[model samples]
Target: MKRIVITGTSRGIGFEMVQLFAQQDCEILALSRNPKPVQELNLSNVTALPFDLASTKDLENVESFLKENWSSVDILINNAGKLVNKPFTEITAEELFSVYQTNAVGTFQLTQKVVPMMKSDGHVVSISTMGGVQGSLKFPGLSAYSSSKAAIITLTELLAEEYKESGPSFNVLALGAVKTEMLAEAFPGYEPPTTAREMASYIANFAQTGAQFYNGKLLQVSNSTP
Candidate 1:
Protein backbone atom coordinates (compact mmCIF):
# COMPACT_ATOMS: atom_id res chain seq x y z
CA MET A 1 0.00 0.00 0.00
CA LYS A 2 1.16 3.52 -0.73
CA ARG A 3 2.18 5.58 2.27
CA ILE A 4 0.71 9.10 2.24
CA VAL A 5 1.02 12.09 4.53
CA ILE A 6 -1.68 14.76 4.59
CA THR A 7 -1.66 17.89 6.73
CA GLY A 8 -4.72 19.95 7.79
CA THR A 9 -6.86 16.92 8.14
CA SER A 10 -9.15 18.00 10.95
CA ARG A 11 -11.82 19.47 8.72
CA GLY A 12 -12.79 21.02 5.38
CA ILE A 13 -10.92 19.79 2.32
CA GLY A 14 -8.26 18.10 4.37
CA PHE A 15 -10.83 16.17 6.35
CA GLU A 16 -12.80 15.18 3.29
CA MET A 17 -9.65 14.15 1.48
CA VAL A 18 -8.81 11.84 4.31
CA GLN A 19 -12.11 10.08 3.80
CA LEU A 20 -11.50 9.87 0.08
CA PHE A 21 -8.01 8.44 0.42
CA ALA A 22 -9.10 6.02 3.08
CA GLN A 23 -11.17 4.21 0.50
CA GLN A 24 -8.09 3.54 -1.57
CA ASP A 25 -5.49 0.87 -0.98
CA CYS A 26 -2.99 2.98 0.93
CA GLU A 27 -1.80 4.00 4.36
CA ILE A 28 -2.55 7.58 5.39
CA LEU A 29 -1.06 9.86 8.01
CA ALA A 30 -3.58 12.57 8.83
CA LEU A 31 -2.13 15.55 10.65
CA SER A 32 -4.04 18.41 12.20
CA ARG A 33 -3.97 20.57 15.30
CA ASN A 34 -7.09 18.71 16.43
CA PRO A 35 -6.59 15.10 15.47
CA LYS A 36 -9.69 13.78 17.17
CA PRO A 37 -11.91 14.23 14.11
CA VAL A 38 -9.80 11.99 11.95
CA GLN A 39 -9.08 9.58 14.75
CA GLU A 40 -12.79 9.12 15.16
CA LEU A 41 -13.04 7.88 11.61
CA ASN A 42 -10.98 4.90 12.69
CA LEU A 43 -10.01 3.88 9.21
CA SER A 44 -7.84 0.81 9.19
CA ASN A 45 -4.99 2.38 7.26
CA VAL A 46 -5.21 5.93 8.54
CA THR A 47 -3.29 7.31 11.53
CA ALA A 48 -4.45 10.60 12.99
CA LEU A 49 -1.92 12.74 14.85
CA PRO A 50 -2.16 16.15 16.42
CA PHE A 51 0.02 18.42 14.29
CA ASP A 52 0.61 22.12 14.03
CA LEU A 53 2.50 23.42 11.06
CA ALA A 54 3.96 26.24 13.17
CA SER A 55 5.22 23.93 15.90
CA THR A 56 8.64 22.31 15.69
CA LYS A 57 7.51 19.60 18.04
CA ASP A 58 4.71 18.59 15.70
CA LEU A 59 7.15 18.24 12.85
CA GLU A 60 9.26 15.94 14.98
CA ASN A 61 6.18 13.88 15.74
CA VAL A 62 5.57 13.22 12.08
CA GLU A 63 9.20 12.37 11.48
CA SER A 64 9.17 9.89 14.30
CA PHE A 65 6.08 8.24 12.87
CA LEU A 66 7.64 7.88 9.44
CA LYS A 67 10.88 6.53 10.77
CA GLU A 68 9.10 3.90 12.80
CA ASN A 69 6.20 2.69 10.68
CA TRP A 70 6.97 3.27 7.04
CA SER A 71 9.94 2.70 4.79
CA SER A 72 8.90 5.41 2.31
CA VAL A 73 6.21 8.00 1.61
CA ASP A 74 4.51 8.02 -1.76
CA ILE A 75 2.68 11.29 -1.33
CA LEU A 76 2.94 14.36 0.88
CA ILE A 77 -0.09 16.67 0.69
CA ASN A 78 0.64 20.09 2.15
CA ASN A 79 -2.97 21.02 2.74
CA ALA A 80 -2.87 22.84 6.07
CA GLY A 81 -3.20 26.62 5.98
CA LYS A 82 -3.59 29.60 8.33
CA LEU A 83 -5.61 32.67 7.46
CA VAL A 84 -5.93 36.15 8.94
CA ASN A 85 -8.46 38.68 7.71
CA LYS A 86 -7.69 42.29 8.51
CA PRO A 87 -6.53 45.59 7.05
CA PHE A 88 -2.83 45.96 6.26
CA THR A 89 -2.27 48.38 9.13
CA GLU A 90 -4.31 46.26 11.48
CA ILE A 91 -2.31 43.15 10.75
CA THR A 92 0.52 42.71 13.21
CA ALA A 93 3.98 41.28 12.69
CA GLU A 94 2.98 38.40 14.86
CA GLU A 95 0.04 37.60 12.63
CA LEU A 96 2.12 37.76 9.48
CA PHE A 97 4.82 35.62 11.02
CA SER A 98 2.30 33.10 12.21
CA VAL A 99 0.87 32.83 8.75
CA TYR A 100 4.26 32.35 7.18
CA GLN A 101 5.31 30.03 9.94
CA THR A 102 2.59 27.55 9.07
CA ASN A 103 2.08 28.10 5.35
CA ALA A 104 5.71 28.49 4.32
CA VAL A 105 8.44 27.69 6.80
CA GLY A 106 6.70 24.78 8.43
CA THR A 107 5.76 23.35 5.08
CA PHE A 108 9.33 23.67 3.89
CA GLN A 109 10.67 21.94 6.96
CA LEU A 110 8.18 19.11 6.79
CA THR A 111 8.81 18.53 3.10
CA GLN A 112 12.54 18.42 3.70
CA LYS A 113 11.97 15.82 6.36
CA VAL A 114 9.75 13.71 4.13
CA VAL A 115 11.57 13.94 0.78
CA PRO A 116 14.42 11.69 1.77
CA MET A 117 11.94 8.96 2.56
CA MET A 118 10.20 9.21 -0.79
CA LYS A 119 11.11 7.50 -4.02
CA SER A 120 11.94 9.52 -7.09
CA ASP A 121 8.43 8.90 -8.30
CA GLY A 122 6.75 10.25 -5.19
CA HIS A 123 4.70 13.48 -5.30
CA VAL A 124 4.43 16.57 -3.13
CA VAL A 125 1.20 18.48 -3.68
CA SER A 126 0.90 21.83 -1.93
CA ILE A 127 -2.36 23.75 -1.63
CA SER A 128 -2.31 27.48 -2.33
CA THR A 129 -4.96 30.16 -2.77
CA MET A 130 -5.69 31.85 -6.07
CA GLY A 131 -4.92 35.10 -4.34
CA GLY A 132 -1.31 33.92 -4.04
CA VAL A 133 -0.94 33.69 -7.81
CA GLN A 134 0.92 36.65 -9.27
CA GLY A 135 -1.39 38.94 -11.30
CA SER A 136 -4.46 37.15 -10.05
CA LEU A 137 -7.43 39.00 -8.58
CA LYS A 138 -6.67 40.37 -5.15
CA PHE A 139 -8.99 40.39 -2.17
CA PRO A 140 -9.33 42.51 0.89
CA GLY A 141 -8.14 41.46 4.37
CA LEU A 142 -5.97 38.56 3.25
CA SER A 143 -2.59 40.22 3.06
CA ALA A 144 -0.92 37.75 5.38
CA TYR A 145 -2.63 34.61 4.20
CA SER A 146 -2.25 35.23 0.49
CA SER A 147 1.35 36.29 0.56
CA SER A 148 2.29 33.40 2.79
CA LYS A 149 0.71 30.97 0.36
CA ALA A 150 2.58 32.55 -2.53
CA ALA A 151 5.80 31.42 -0.95
CA ILE A 152 4.83 27.79 -1.44
CA ILE A 153 4.29 28.37 -5.14
CA THR A 154 7.86 29.52 -5.62
CA LEU A 155 9.17 26.87 -3.26
CA THR A 156 7.47 24.19 -5.31
CA GLU A 157 9.19 25.36 -8.46
CA LEU A 158 12.55 25.50 -6.73
CA LEU A 159 12.21 22.02 -5.31
CA ALA A 160 11.20 20.56 -8.67
CA GLU A 161 14.27 22.12 -10.28
CA GLU A 162 16.56 20.79 -7.57
CA TYR A 163 15.07 17.31 -7.68
CA LYS A 164 14.42 16.96 -11.40
CA GLU A 165 16.90 14.18 -11.78
CA SER A 166 16.33 12.56 -8.44
CA GLY A 167 12.62 11.93 -9.07
CA PRO A 168 9.57 12.73 -6.88
CA SER A 169 7.96 15.81 -8.41
CA PHE A 170 6.69 18.96 -6.72
CA ASN A 171 3.69 20.99 -7.83
CA VAL A 172 1.17 23.39 -6.30
CA LEU A 173 -2.55 23.95 -6.74
CA ALA A 174 -3.81 27.50 -6.37
CA LEU A 175 -7.48 27.20 -5.55
CA GLY A 176 -10.32 29.70 -5.74
CA ALA A 177 -13.67 30.17 -4.00
CA VAL A 178 -13.97 26.87 -2.26
CA LYS A 179 -16.84 26.65 0.25
CA THR A 180 -14.74 26.10 3.33
CA GLU A 181 -14.55 27.47 6.84
CA MET A 182 -11.46 29.48 5.89
CA LEU A 183 -13.33 30.92 2.94
CA ALA A 184 -16.23 31.96 5.13
CA GLU A 185 -13.79 33.53 7.54
CA ALA A 186 -12.04 35.45 4.80
CA PHE A 187 -15.08 36.57 2.86
CA PRO A 188 -18.24 36.69 4.90
CA GLY A 189 -21.58 36.53 3.05
CA TYR A 190 -19.84 35.26 -0.03
CA GLU A 191 -21.19 32.02 -1.44
CA PRO A 192 -18.58 29.88 -3.09
CA PRO A 193 -19.67 27.52 -5.84
CA THR A 194 -17.27 24.73 -5.05
CA THR A 195 -17.80 22.45 -2.09
CA ALA A 196 -15.12 20.96 0.12
CA ARG A 197 -15.83 17.43 -0.97
CA GLU A 198 -15.75 18.43 -4.61
CA MET A 199 -12.36 20.03 -4.29
CA ALA A 200 -11.08 17.15 -2.24
CA SER A 201 -12.08 14.70 -4.94
CA TYR A 202 -9.97 16.50 -7.48
CA ILE A 203 -7.01 16.99 -5.17
CA ALA A 204 -7.14 13.40 -4.02
CA ASN A 205 -6.76 12.17 -7.60
CA PHE A 206 -4.10 14.71 -8.45
CA ALA A 207 -1.96 13.96 -5.42
CA GLN A 208 -1.62 10.42 -6.66
CA THR A 209 -1.01 10.94 -10.41
CA GLY A 210 -0.12 14.59 -11.02
CA ALA A 211 3.59 13.95 -10.55
CA GLN A 212 3.70 11.75 -13.60
CA PHE A 213 2.70 14.59 -15.90
CA TYR A 214 3.60 17.72 -13.97
CA ASN A 215 6.42 19.08 -11.86
CA GLY A 216 7.49 22.50 -10.69
CA LYS A 217 4.23 23.98 -11.96
CA LEU A 218 1.32 25.81 -10.41
CA LEU A 219 -2.21 24.99 -11.52
CA GLN A 220 -4.87 27.59 -10.75
CA VAL A 221 -8.05 25.70 -9.88
CA SER A 222 -11.16 27.83 -10.18
CA ASN A 223 -14.60 27.79 -11.69
CA SER A 224 -15.81 31.22 -10.69
CA THR A 225 -17.63 33.00 -13.46
CA PRO A 226 -17.48 36.75 -13.68
Candidate 2:
Protein backbone atom coordinates (compact mmCIF):
# COMPACT_ATOMS: atom_id res chain seq x y z
CA MET A 1 0.00 0.00 0.00
CA LYS A 2 1.18 3.51 -0.78
CA ARG A 3 1.79 5.69 2.25
CA ILE A 4 0.67 9.30 1.89
CA VAL A 5 0.67 12.37 4.11
CA ILE A 6 -1.71 15.31 3.70
CA THR A 7 -2.30 18.51 5.57
CA GLY A 8 -5.53 20.42 6.29
CA THR A 9 -7.77 17.38 6.39
CA SER A 10 -10.47 18.80 8.65
CA ARG A 11 -12.68 20.24 5.89
CA GLY A 12 -13.05 21.42 2.33
CA ILE A 13 -10.76 19.74 -0.24
CA GLY A 14 -8.63 18.19 2.48
CA PHE A 15 -11.56 16.29 3.98
CA GLU A 16 -12.65 14.96 0.61
CA MET A 17 -9.12 13.82 -0.18
CA VAL A 18 -8.89 11.81 3.01
CA GLN A 19 -12.15 10.06 2.16
CA LEU A 20 -11.16 9.38 -1.44
CA PHE A 21 -7.72 8.02 -0.58
CA ALA A 22 -9.13 5.82 2.15
CA GLN A 23 -11.45 4.24 -0.42
CA GLN A 24 -8.43 3.56 -2.64
CA ASP A 25 -6.79 1.50 0.11
CA CYS A 26 -3.98 4.02 0.70
CA GLU A 27 -2.58 4.67 4.16
CA ILE A 28 -3.15 8.31 5.06
CA LEU A 29 -1.47 10.51 7.64
CA ALA A 30 -3.68 13.59 7.71
CA LEU A 31 -3.14 16.81 9.67
CA SER A 32 -5.68 19.39 10.73
CA ARG A 33 -6.32 21.98 13.43
CA ASN A 34 -9.17 20.12 15.02
CA PRO A 35 -9.01 16.60 16.44
CA LYS A 36 -12.64 15.66 16.74
CA PRO A 37 -14.61 13.68 14.10
CA VAL A 38 -11.49 12.53 12.19
CA GLN A 39 -11.67 9.40 14.25
CA GLU A 40 -15.28 8.99 13.23
CA LEU A 41 -14.17 8.26 9.66
CA ASN A 42 -13.10 4.91 11.09
CA LEU A 43 -10.64 3.97 8.34
CA SER A 44 -8.06 1.57 9.66
CA ASN A 45 -5.23 3.22 7.75
CA VAL A 46 -6.28 6.78 8.48
CA THR A 47 -4.43 8.80 11.12
CA ALA A 48 -5.59 12.38 11.71
CA LEU A 49 -3.03 14.64 13.37
CA PRO A 50 -4.42 17.82 14.89
CA PHE A 51 -2.17 20.90 15.01
CA ASP A 52 -2.08 24.48 13.85
CA LEU A 53 -0.03 25.10 10.75
CA ALA A 54 0.84 28.61 11.85
CA SER A 55 3.16 27.05 14.39
CA THR A 56 6.26 26.28 12.39
CA LYS A 57 7.78 24.50 15.37
CA ASP A 58 5.03 21.91 15.15
CA LEU A 59 6.65 20.59 11.99
CA GLU A 60 9.57 19.22 13.96
CA ASN A 61 7.23 17.24 16.12
CA VAL A 62 5.36 16.05 13.07
CA GLU A 63 8.59 14.92 11.47
CA SER A 64 9.60 13.10 14.61
CA PHE A 65 6.28 11.33 14.77
CA LEU A 66 6.47 10.28 11.14
CA LYS A 67 10.04 9.03 11.54
CA GLU A 68 9.12 7.03 14.61
CA ASN A 69 6.19 5.39 12.86
CA TRP A 70 6.26 5.30 9.06
CA SER A 71 9.27 4.24 7.02
CA SER A 72 8.79 6.61 4.10
CA VAL A 73 6.00 8.53 2.41
CA ASP A 74 5.09 7.76 -1.19
CA ILE A 75 3.08 10.96 -1.54
CA LEU A 76 2.98 14.25 0.31
CA ILE A 77 0.05 16.58 -0.40
CA ASN A 78 0.26 20.15 0.83
CA ASN A 79 -3.42 21.06 0.90
CA ALA A 80 -3.61 23.45 3.84
CA GLY A 81 -4.23 27.14 3.13
CA LYS A 82 -5.66 30.38 4.50
CA LEU A 83 -7.42 33.23 2.72
CA VAL A 84 -8.52 36.71 3.75
CA ASN A 85 -10.88 38.93 1.77
CA LYS A 86 -9.77 42.34 3.01
CA PRO A 87 -9.00 45.05 0.48
CA PHE A 88 -5.32 45.69 -0.20
CA THR A 89 -5.44 48.91 1.69
CA GLU A 90 -7.68 47.55 4.40
CA ILE A 91 -5.73 44.41 5.11
CA THR A 92 -3.41 44.86 8.07
CA ALA A 93 0.21 43.75 7.94
CA GLU A 94 -0.64 41.07 10.48
CA GLU A 95 -3.44 39.77 8.30
CA LEU A 96 -1.11 39.54 5.34
CA PHE A 97 1.44 37.79 7.51
CA SER A 98 -1.21 35.35 8.65
CA VAL A 99 -2.04 34.49 5.07
CA TYR A 100 1.60 33.78 4.23
CA GLN A 101 2.15 31.99 7.49
CA THR A 102 -0.32 29.25 6.72
CA ASN A 103 -0.38 29.19 2.93
CA ALA A 104 3.29 29.66 2.14
CA VAL A 105 5.53 29.33 5.18
CA GLY A 106 3.67 26.38 6.59
CA THR A 107 3.79 24.60 3.27
CA PHE A 108 7.44 25.45 2.75
CA GLN A 109 8.43 24.24 6.17
CA LEU A 110 6.36 21.07 5.97
CA THR A 111 7.69 20.26 2.53
CA GLN A 112 11.24 20.88 3.65
CA LYS A 113 10.80 18.51 6.56
CA VAL A 114 9.22 15.80 4.41
CA VAL A 115 11.60 15.80 1.44
CA PRO A 116 14.21 13.73 3.22
CA MET A 117 11.55 11.31 4.40
CA MET A 118 10.11 10.62 0.97
CA LYS A 119 10.74 7.29 -0.73
CA SER A 120 12.35 6.90 -4.11
CA ASP A 121 9.99 7.83 -6.93
CA GLY A 122 7.68 9.54 -4.45
CA HIS A 123 5.53 12.53 -5.44
CA VAL A 124 4.60 15.85 -3.85
CA VAL A 125 1.48 17.80 -4.75
CA SER A 126 1.18 21.40 -3.70
CA ILE A 127 -2.41 22.69 -3.77
CA SER A 128 -2.38 26.17 -5.21
CA THR A 129 -5.03 28.50 -6.67
CA MET A 130 -5.74 29.69 -10.17
CA GLY A 131 -5.59 33.09 -8.59
CA GLY A 132 -1.84 32.51 -8.40
CA VAL A 133 -1.49 32.37 -12.14
CA GLN A 134 -0.63 35.46 -14.14
CA GLY A 135 -3.74 37.28 -15.44
CA SER A 136 -5.82 35.72 -12.71
CA LEU A 137 -7.74 38.68 -11.36
CA LYS A 138 -7.66 40.06 -7.87
CA PHE A 139 -11.27 40.99 -7.26
CA PRO A 140 -11.73 43.82 -4.73
CA GLY A 141 -9.80 42.64 -1.66
CA LEU A 142 -7.93 39.47 -2.52
CA SER A 143 -4.43 40.90 -2.88
CA ALA A 144 -3.01 39.08 0.12
CA TYR A 145 -4.68 35.81 -0.71
CA SER A 146 -3.60 35.96 -4.33
CA SER A 147 -0.07 36.96 -3.50
CA SER A 148 0.47 34.19 -1.00
CA LYS A 149 -0.84 31.53 -3.34
CA ALA A 150 1.34 32.95 -6.08
CA ALA A 151 4.31 32.54 -3.81
CA ILE A 152 3.40 28.89 -3.33
CA ILE A 153 3.31 28.39 -7.09
CA THR A 154 6.79 29.81 -7.41
CA LEU A 155 7.97 27.65 -4.55
CA THR A 156 6.59 24.62 -6.35
CA GLU A 157 8.51 25.53 -9.49
CA LEU A 158 11.70 25.98 -7.51
CA LEU A 159 11.23 22.59 -5.87
CA ALA A 160 10.81 20.91 -9.23
CA GLU A 161 14.16 22.30 -10.27
CA GLU A 162 15.99 21.76 -7.00
CA TYR A 163 14.87 18.16 -6.75
CA LYS A 164 15.07 17.20 -10.40
CA GLU A 165 17.60 14.46 -9.76
CA SER A 166 16.12 13.50 -6.40
CA GLY A 167 14.06 10.37 -6.04
CA PRO A 168 10.76 12.27 -5.62
CA SER A 169 8.97 14.60 -8.03
CA PHE A 170 7.07 17.82 -7.33
CA ASN A 171 4.03 19.43 -8.96
CA VAL A 172 1.60 22.23 -8.30
CA LEU A 173 -2.16 22.19 -8.87
CA ALA A 174 -3.75 25.59 -9.40
CA LEU A 175 -7.29 24.73 -8.50
CA GLY A 176 -10.12 26.73 -10.01
CA ALA A 177 -12.78 28.27 -7.82
CA VAL A 178 -14.13 25.29 -5.95
CA LYS A 179 -17.38 25.17 -3.98
CA THR A 180 -15.80 25.01 -0.58
CA GLU A 181 -16.32 27.03 2.57
CA MET A 182 -13.26 29.05 1.60
CA LEU A 183 -14.97 30.10 -1.63
CA ALA A 184 -18.19 30.86 0.20
CA GLU A 185 -16.29 32.98 2.68
CA ALA A 186 -14.39 34.79 -0.06
CA PHE A 187 -17.37 35.38 -2.34
CA PRO A 188 -20.39 35.09 -0.14
CA GLY A 189 -23.07 36.00 -2.68
CA TYR A 190 -21.64 33.94 -5.52
CA GLU A 191 -23.46 30.87 -6.79
CA PRO A 192 -22.36 27.37 -5.84
CA PRO A 193 -19.11 26.26 -7.44
CA THR A 194 -17.43 22.90 -8.12
CA THR A 195 -18.05 20.13 -5.68
CA ALA A 196 -15.30 18.97 -3.31
CA ARG A 197 -15.90 15.38 -4.39
CA GLU A 198 -15.14 16.19 -8.03
CA MET A 199 -12.10 18.17 -7.06
CA ALA A 200 -10.98 15.32 -4.83
CA SER A 201 -11.26 12.84 -7.68
CA TYR A 202 -9.35 15.17 -9.94
CA ILE A 203 -6.62 15.53 -7.33
CA ALA A 204 -6.47 11.79 -6.78
CA ASN A 205 -6.10 11.18 -10.49
CA PHE A 206 -3.52 13.91 -10.69
CA ALA A 207 -1.57 12.39 -7.84
CA GLN A 208 -1.46 9.15 -9.77
CA THR A 209 -0.34 10.52 -13.16
CA GLY A 210 0.25 14.25 -12.91
CA ALA A 211 4.02 14.01 -12.50
CA GLN A 212 4.23 12.40 -15.91
CA PHE A 213 2.73 15.46 -17.60
CA TYR A 214 3.79 18.30 -15.30
CA ASN A 215 7.00 18.37 -13.33
CA GLY A 216 7.30 22.13 -12.92
CA LYS A 217 4.17 23.26 -14.78
CA LEU A 218 1.08 24.64 -13.13
CA LEU A 219 -1.93 22.41 -13.71
CA GLN A 220 -4.94 24.68 -13.63
CA VAL A 221 -8.05 22.78 -12.67
CA SER A 222 -10.41 24.26 -15.28
CA ASN A 223 -8.01 24.21 -18.22
CA SER A 224 -5.49 21.50 -17.44
CA THR A 225 -7.93 18.63 -17.03
CA PRO A 226 -11.60 17.71 -16.88
List TM-scores for all candidates, in order: 0.98, 0.94
- With a 3 Å backbone cut-off (N, CA, C), the pairs that clash in candidate 2 are none
Q: How many residue pairs clash in each candidate?
A: 1, 0
Off by over 4 Å in 2: 223-226
Residue 21 error, candidate 2, Å: 0.4
* Tens digit of per-residue lDDT, candidate 1, span 1-226: 8889999999999999999998996899999999999999989899999998888888898899999999999999999999999998999989989999999999999999999999999999999999999999998788899999999999999999999999789999999999999998998889989999999999999998898899999999999821
- Model 2 scores a TM of 0.94
lDDT for model 2 comes to 0.83
lDDT of 2 by residue, 61-88 (tens): 7898889998988899999888898767
Where's the lowest-lDDT run of ten residues in candidate 1? 217-226
Q: All candidates: CA RMSD in angstroms?
A: 1.0, 2.2
